[model samples]
Target: MKILIAEYAGFCFGVKRAIETAYYEIEKNSGRKIYMLGEIIHNPQVISDLSKKGVNIIEEEELDKLTEGDKLIIRSHGVSKKLYDFLAKKGIEVIDVTCPFVKKVQDIVYEHYHKGYSIIIVGDRNHPEVRGVNGWCDDTAYVVNSIEEAHKLPKLEKACAVAQTTLIGRYWEDILEVIKLKVKDLVFFNTICDATQKRQGSAEQLSKKVDVMFVIGGKHSSNTQKLKKICEKNCKNTFHIEDAKELTLEMVKDREIIGITAGASTPDYVIEEVIKKIRFLKGEKEEE
Candidate 1:
């Protein structure tokens, strides 16, 4: 089958940097125990591959129990500064792999919080990145994903708003609009990364022309979920899969135009394999 791919899909700058850093940390700590604070970049395959290389993914609780000499690697989603300091106090080695984009947000939020503005974090409420952002302000920052929350802000005499890099584009705009009206003094930093914006735009554009769309990325990846949501709005035949193995042959048997797009955390080879399987099952001639 002729598969059209999104030009912007896969390994945004931040995720690429994070993954590269993790692998390098693994190599550097050879013959020594290396633990990842969380799945490095949300991709199960990537974490599984790291595990094969002796890198262990540990929970905060388990890591809390680790001895002073143990080494822990932070994921691309930056941890709260409090956690970093705590680890140092415990004499644990820390390898910070937080994305530069995330670090920038933390810096901005820290500055605004100290300046006496109530912080508003725009993103998923439970996402690690969002939680980390909230922790910067002692969890005083308001976390909201919809316009309703923005309108209900008890009061916004002075506020600073920031969005998670992988949020729905329009939702960010909507929240900003409402908050602008209610707050007497407001500042907003569009922290949404370019990679996410491009991917979301490309996914929507492809969905309009394709008969079936497959979104490939880690199940836990926020950006991947956003891409799928964008595609679903434009196409009914949208499927979100981490790998081709998760796709069934029957679903695309009748589809003539297939579109494949992956998330920032998805590797190129995984997308290639899914395209290969789709062509094989559909009995369509593969494009060179």
Candidate 2:
């Protein structure tokens, strides 16, 4: 059996920075209660490790119960302007670890919305990143995730658009084309993360050459799910698993070639474990 692992799999720059920031805060504020507004990143293994180290994940509804002296770490997905303001008003110390790429999109929406241009976000409506961007525009932005949604958008005189950092490039272009026809004036920024583009591109290419493909990441991770979807279109035997424990012999039996890729939030160790398991199942010696 031959195995091909993606050259760009696992943590990207932003996720690495965010995870490091969380650890730094934990070390610097010893004995203080540290709470993350949500999962520092999308990976379950990473979150579990952090929890064991005393980092707690707090939900939106739990915000009101927090008081002064509690440290809040903002997830990489960023938060809405309202959430930021509310946190400030509550007197909680906030450590913003929002990814720089996501911050750029928030700034763009804020600047253009104030200038009288309608804001259009090309991505999932419910995604935290898109919700954060919409918050800057006072929740007035139109969230379009499909060609059908873009076509249904009312004609506008002037509009400015940005994409969720993890959006697929082709889908973004498809939606943008329809919006261009409907709007008299349109300004669109392709905010999809560069790493995401490269990872998805590599996954698509590898899927075409492999008998089976594995996309490893958190089940709730948007980018991971996108990778799985892209791979499935090319390779019928695509599987999305969170870790090596989910691997089964039946899935790999008789497969001549296999490909593996992971989401931005996945850690190197988790990817290594999955690769090691695959090698073991195939009766191949592990790499040094």
Candidate 3:
């Protein structure tokens, strides 16, 4: 069996920066308590490594428990404006590691919202990044993830649209086109991250050439799920796995070629392990 790994797999610039920043802050203030609002990134392995290093992951409800001098790291997914304000009001030292691409979407929403333009975000509403962007617009922005949702929106006199940084490019275009038809005066910004586009594009192309495809990343990761969906469209045998341990021999037994792609937050070691497991499985079958 042949294994084809994607050219654009593993950590992206933003995720890399966030992880590095977390480590730097942890080391810089060894005695102070450090907490992250959520997982610094979506990968379990990375989060586990950080937790072993004394970093604590706290939920939103735990915010009030924090006191002055406590350091809170804003995750790469960013947070709502209200959350930021609340953290400041509580006097917790905030180390913002929000991805620049996500920050750009927030800034754009804030600017257009204040200028009397209705904000429309083309992505999953429940996603942390989308929720953060919505917060900047006072939770008034319309979050649409599909062409169906876009069509349901009421006609607007003025509006500005921005996509979640990890949204698939084709899905964004499809939703945007529907929004354009509904809004009289629309300003659209393609806020999808460049890395995301390349990753999705590469996954799609690779899936077409392989008999089975494995998309590796955290199950909760939006981008990783998007990659799985993209690959599924081209290769029906696509499987989404968080790690190599989830792989079964039945998934690989008859496939002549396998393609592997990972999300931005996936670590190199996880990808390597998955590849190794597949090779071992193939070798054992050959010996049989």
lDDT of 1 by residue, 1-288 (tens): 457998789888878888888788778888898888978898988889999999888987776687898989888888887888889999998888888888889999999999999999988989999988887887899888888877887767999999998898899998999888878899999999877898999889999989899999998889999898999988899999999788787779778888989998999889888987787677664534
List candidate 2 segments past 4 Å from native. Answer: 285-288
My TM-score estimates for the predictions, one after another, are 0.96, 0.97, 0.96
lDDT string for model 3 (141-193, tens) is 99998988998999999999999999999888889889999999999999999
Candidate 3: give the clashing pairs: none
Q: List the candidate numbers ranked by lDDT, top first.
A: 3, 2, 1
Give candidate 2's error at residue 201 in angstroms: 0.9
Residue 243 shift from truth in candidate 3, angstroms: 0.8
Candidate whose TM-score is highest: 2
Question: Each candidate: RMSD to true structure?
Answer: 2.0, 1.6, 2.0
Assess each prediction's global lDDT (C-alpha) against the native: 0.87, 0.93, 0.93
How high is the lDDT of residue 261 in model 1? 91
Alpha-carbon runs more than 4 Å astray in model 1: 284-288
Q: What TM-score would candidate 3 get against the native?
A: 0.96
